[model samples]
Target chain A: MKIAIIQFGGSNCDMDVLHIFKDILNVNAELVWYKNKDLSGYDGVVLPGGFSYGDYLRSGAIASRTPIMDSVKKIANEGKPVLGICNGFQILTEASLLDGALMTNSYPKFICDWTYLKVENNNTIFTSRFNEGEVIKIPVAHKEGNYYNTPERLNELNNNHQVAFRYVNQKGHLTNESNPNGSVENIAGITNSKGNVLGLMPHPERAAESILGSKDGLKLFLSMVDYFSNE
Target chain B: MEYYAEVTVQLKDGMLDPEGSTIKRALEHLGYSPKDVKSAKKFIITIESESIDKAKDTVDEMCRRLIANPVIHDYSIIMREA
Candidate 1:
């Protein structure tokens, strides 16, 4: 399946995503520059991490206005799987493709570490590889990964099962300290109402190999592969 | 006529502002009893317009379209002749 990795100016994780998908997963993935608006050939799309538009005004705020995002939105609307990681998550929210904004971390520092994620909903295309409530380790690197949404909206998201992942301890218990960012409800990852567009603060591509300290992330990518092959 | 539009964007009330809170804490540490600190962004844009009323409408539109995120931010626009 052909996958397009949208690359905006200052998007550093574009290469890493391409390498993981092309070299590791053997998926036909190409990096599409921000100005190239056409995205018809790609079956799936990924907006990986990095300080897009130099994180000016806000993380992903300026990048979201780039030309290529219009095509990305169209693909997402067509029910194609669109995954946004780190700054990519910020861009998705900024573009209104996803709900809520990622704010500065509560501690007010950039955090870079491995954290445990609990699979809150395994029924979606993005999390179907893992069982519900399963714990997986992934790396998170961002200054503004804290997710914020109105309390009413958070409840709505929960009722719809749009919340796909939540922060948890190694033992799989959700606690205040387990949350690296002060995101309400410890949200680590979430999906669109249609269950196609997925956004998360962690770098799943960085965790695709066991040599990188965790292989848990590969399952999610493999799940994407499974999702397209079945379609 | 040249009109200057100044836009101030702030987080919606009741939303948490970590950066603002951090600043509040720092002030408290320095013996200031500031109960809260809310941060906002200001953008000034100069444009040609036929009238002040027309400029006001245009700047308001700009706020909705680009200067503010309606979901999390509330923005106000002020227009003045330049």
Candidate 2:
């Protein structure tokens, strides 16, 4: 399946994700510039991480308003898979494609470290390869990754099984120490109610190779491929 | 009419302001007792419209659409003749 990895200005991780998709996953993936608004040809889209627009105004504010997001949204609404990572997740929230917002971390420091993610739901196309409650290693690097939403809305997300992943400890337990960012409910990722769109703060692309410390991230991309193949 | 609209965007009440809290702690270390702290952003925008009411509407829409994220922020706009 052909995947469009949309690249915005200042997006540094575009190449890395492109390499993973092409070299590791053996998939046909291309780096599509943000100005290229046509995504109809691609089977899936990925918004890679970086300081788009130099993170002016907010982490993903300026980039979310760009013309390319319209095409991204159009494809997402068509039930095509869309994966947003790190700053990409911020853009999805800013674009209102996903629920909640990624706010400044509670420590208010630029955090770069590895984190354990407990797969809260595995029913989606993005997580079908994983088992519910399975824990995986991923890396996160950002200053604004604290996910926030109103209490009622959070409950709605939980009830709807939209929370796809959450921060956890080695023993698969949720704790304050495990929560690198003070996200409400220690959330690290979430999916849209339809389960076609997934957004997360961690850099799964960085962890896709064993040499990079973990190959746990490969399953996420593989899951998408499996979905497309099944269709 | 040319109008200047000053928009203030702040996190909604009960939302934690980590930067503000860190600053508050620093102030305490300096022997100053502070109840709490909050951080906000201010944007001064100039808009040309037919009337003051229209200018207010434009500024308000800007805040709603761009300047503020309704999920966690509240914004206020003050319009005056430019």
- Whose lDDT is greatest here? 2
- Every model's TM-score on chain B: 0.94, 0.92
**Model 1 chain A worst lDDT window (10 residues):** A123-132
Root-mean-square deviation (CA) per prediction: 1.3, 1.0
| Colliding pairs, model 1 | none
For each candidate, the DockQ is 0.68, 0.89
Model 2 residue pairs with clashes: none
Model 1 regions lying over 4 Å from their true place: none
Native contacts recovered by model 1: 0.60
